[model samples]
Target: MITFNRVRSSILKAKDHRRQLLGIHETDVLRASIAEAPHFRALLSEIQAEAERARREPAPELSFTDFHLFAAQGTRIEYEKPYFERRGRLLALALEAWLHPEQKDLDALQNEIWMLCNEYSWALPAHLPYTLEGVASSRVTMPEVVDLFASETAHALAETLYLLEGRLNPWVVHRVREEIERRIFRPMFDTPNTFPWESSTNNWSAVCGGAVGMAALLLVDDRERLAGMTDRVIRAMGSFLEGYEDDGCCAEGVGYWNYGFGYYVYFAEMLYEFTNGKLNLLQGDKIRRIASFPAAVALTAPLYVNFSDCSETYVPNTGLVSRLHRRLGQPVPEMTAVPSLHADHCYRFPHTVRNLLWTDASLLHQPAAEGTFTFPDTAWIIDKHRLAGGLFAFAAKGGHNDEPHNHNDLGHFILHAAGETLLSDLGAGVYTRDYFREGRYTYLHNASEGHSVPLINGLPQAADREHEAAVLKQEVAPDSRLVYSLDLTGAYPKNSGLRSYIRTFEWSGQAEREEAHLRVNDSFTFAEAVNGVEEFFISLQRPILSPGSVTWRGQTGEVKLTYDADTFSAEAEVIESLDHGSHPLTVHRLRLRAGRVPGEASWSFLFTARAL
Candidate 1:
């Protein structure tokens, strides 16, 4: 029952120690570079000027509502106040130190720097012990607090503090470090809680947590502590890699796929610098494919069939790709045709979408070939466009409901068609209050509706039969067209009598076109003969821009099938609006429920399409 107030108070009270611990004598690491490298000097000056402009502007007041809006949009707009202001100051001080290493009078700049850091520390009181209650109604537990506060805001602050050490109080750095370590790192490793950190199910825990750990190593000087921290980080990374089947698709949607993958790259870059390339993550074949995942999803028009909690507003992260290219010692490619946003400072590689798309052409042209497949816990895609193409992919389930940015879609799959995604999984939605974590929001993610499974008894598929239990059984097989299977019989209550649901996606790979037959079989044996079993449906949806058609063929049962392609266009219909100008490509939901209690029931659909 960690309250926001409690966390905030703890953070504030810890400030005194932070100031003392970070009080190291200043040393100008970048001093020689300023004079030796003109580009570095210019960049530093530019950063300082920007910081000055921010300082001159009046601080704007923002409410929790404003924060929610920015979070959802993935924009840091509200940072014009405290968070960004502090970051700007830190950048200025660091640049100033680089540009004027011998300056005897840095008093003014140092004062402003401390003021910003202290102000950030003060503001934590308002948002501490982060809780959904501030946004929702109920008081969440301590683990939830950790999840809420380990946000983009917190990450930004931690990064800024790490980057601008020495200019601010040593104690400030130590305090911020301790707060994050206790609230985020400790709980992540020591506790059984399943936010992003505990679940090795995906790469995000490794990436994001890895980045934080790198920051910690950068700021903390104790050799023993650093070794321990690095060991933990390596283990976490190992967990993420374990989730990577030789293929590369993350069970989490592409959006999370990007988030976790991006963090992996981020941490990898830091690890490269810290270890002088001795411990390179890019060396791994499975890990390297993660870099190209965005390209696979981008091959389809409008990018992906973001059926889960995904929106079209998300564009490719070209900057990340550019960074990867450099890290791997490749030439930076021309990228401008792809839709993208400007790269932020925190990102390791800051190229525009155009750059990545253009460079990724190499990946697309390599060849649509198939190769030896490895079945990790999940089936994922590594080189989706090569010999592996659609042949390589993974599927698995079992992430904590308490995981950061979790959806109730444990058994869902992301399918690639002829090197492009014909039927794909939707990623996450905007992080607004309305969309925060409500699993029942049909359009929010690849939950029950967004997936290829049947919903029995009209109840959402719970991971566990009991509210506190974990998922029943999630398994996959790569040898046959029966590529994967998931049995959620345990998700139901007791004596629901062998109530079992299984989904098998069989794929037939051909040069010109690929076929995917989705078979969902369910058996429910009630103690007493049940009455009217009415509501049921089979749904197959793709993003609007998908250049293929999906026809549903009924296999068994006497259920009426309806087609609502939401679009009037000959090609596809636009149904839901995700952003200002973007609409979710159309969704074709098929429903089949028991008209009356028949003894048992089953349903299936065969989805076939040609590569666009």
Candidate 2:
């Protein structure tokens, strides 16, 4: 058992022997990587063209007032998000141009660099807490501080100074370092990060701590002081790790597991290399299991458990995934899609840079994994069947409602057949102030109603510590049927007149026949007769309805869901996906409503998700 505190004590001794081993120095990152790598020069060239195009357009007007405007508009993706992204990209271009000394317009980049260095605070107005908002007529009650993005913003400046040490004007580096100390270092490390990120169990701990830690390691001249600061960061990461169950489940969803954990690993790699492997940060069973999450949860190439605020269509860093696979001996997930190394999109920087630096092309050649994975830590069951003719899969979850990025979907499941999504989990919606404000579960995607679960007497599942699910049983028969049952009694309001909710899914696959199907049975006991129970299954494809069956036509093939017309009725509705998402998406909500029943009743349906 390696305690991070003990690691910190070792790191306190690290400064005495600190020497850079990051494969390339601040100066050679551009030159050496571009020379050795195939994709490196091309990405840099695209970035260069972007900077060239940007040279003609005046930078967008910046205002602290406009930054806070999105908070009132119920959107975080609109104005400020793009504006800061532009700023970060612009900074990267300047650094890139400096790295490419052959470029003719080096001074043009220097000008853009100066303009950015002059901005008030790199922190976005939208991320400001009421206390941190730089409002006039205010005696700031709290310390004038740095938020998560601001930490990265500061790192960008520090990283620029380090990378372009002699090439840039001396004044630019001095100004950047001064601001890093003023806005980031003094406020964050001088006092301490009592800000919730210090103890966060999610991405916050990694991005905030890792970004600032990289800055301290690169920019700070005080070796002993830097060691102490690095010591503190290791301790915060322990908090992130301590919250994980022994199963290495990232309850936040696969998207965030990639995002947050990516940063943690990024910092780990930097330290590991810097110490020449003396500090083995990648050690431990918890880490290996955490690294294996994507494979366990993935339903297909691009789909996985979108449990919390996680996304369904996401880009996993092939470099990071490959490294983890080599280390843990776990299967590398399929990631044929490429990723941008631009700073505008990264909550990950110095680490995301690894995507370009360490990506192994062989990762794409890894064999596909097909089998049953049971994560009892979070009560999630994933079964992938790779028949000779095609692929079919099913996934279901039964965790508490109070998970990180919590959603009120306890007994939700996803199904895929004929290589297309049939039943789906509409992952995260747009991020608005209200999304995180009061009444979050009211959002359909966050509520139980949006999931494939029954609403008891019109009351959706509750969202608190008390509302949770207990796994009753799980049977895995690989080549046959896989049945999983969970007790959902604790998921709803205690006084909702619902006595129990036992949701079960029996998935069967006939690999030899290229056929796959599922049976869902939900048995409930109520304190009294209820209004109605609606069972919903979300899908990417629209289903055509007949009397007793609904057939969903997708790219792969058609999936037919059959039920007794006399026992239930079905309907469908189309809803908008998240606005300004990475890709445009549309999905159908297929609802099956059963008439009111007595205190004790059961409802069941059958569907063929995959078949030849």
Best by lDDT: 2
Instruction: State how far residue 291 of model 2 sits from its true place (Å).
Output: 1.0
| Candidate 1 structure quality by residue, lDDT tens digits, 1-612 | 223343233323332223322112233443453345432333444556754554565434435564454445433334434444444444454445435545555444555444543332222223333345654642333422443224333454465554455555666666666666655556544544445454555655565566556555455555445555555666666677666556564545556666677666666655555544445567755666665454444433333434344443344454466567655643222233333222233222212211322234332222222332333433332223222223322223433333334455544544444434433444554333345434335543535555444455555555431422233333334543434444555544354443444544444443433333333333344443552322223223432222223332222111121222231112323235343113344454433344334445443434443332
Off by over 4 Å in 1: 1-127, 130-209, 216-249, 277-375, 379-406, 410-426, 430-447, 465-485, 491-498, 509-588, 610-612
Q: 558 in model 2: Cα distance from truth in Å?
A: 3.2
How would you encode candidate 2's per-residue C-alpha lDDT over 336-414 as one tens digit per residue?
6445555225434554455555666667634447888888988888888875445678888998988887889999988
Candidate 2 segments whose C-alpha is farther than 4 A from its true place? 1-21, 25-45, 91-95, 98-101, 131-144, 341-347, 529-531, 577-585
Tell me how far the alpha carbon of residue 450 in candidate 1 is from the true structure, in angstroms, after superposition: 4.4
User: How do all models score by TM-score?
Assistant: 0.54, 0.91
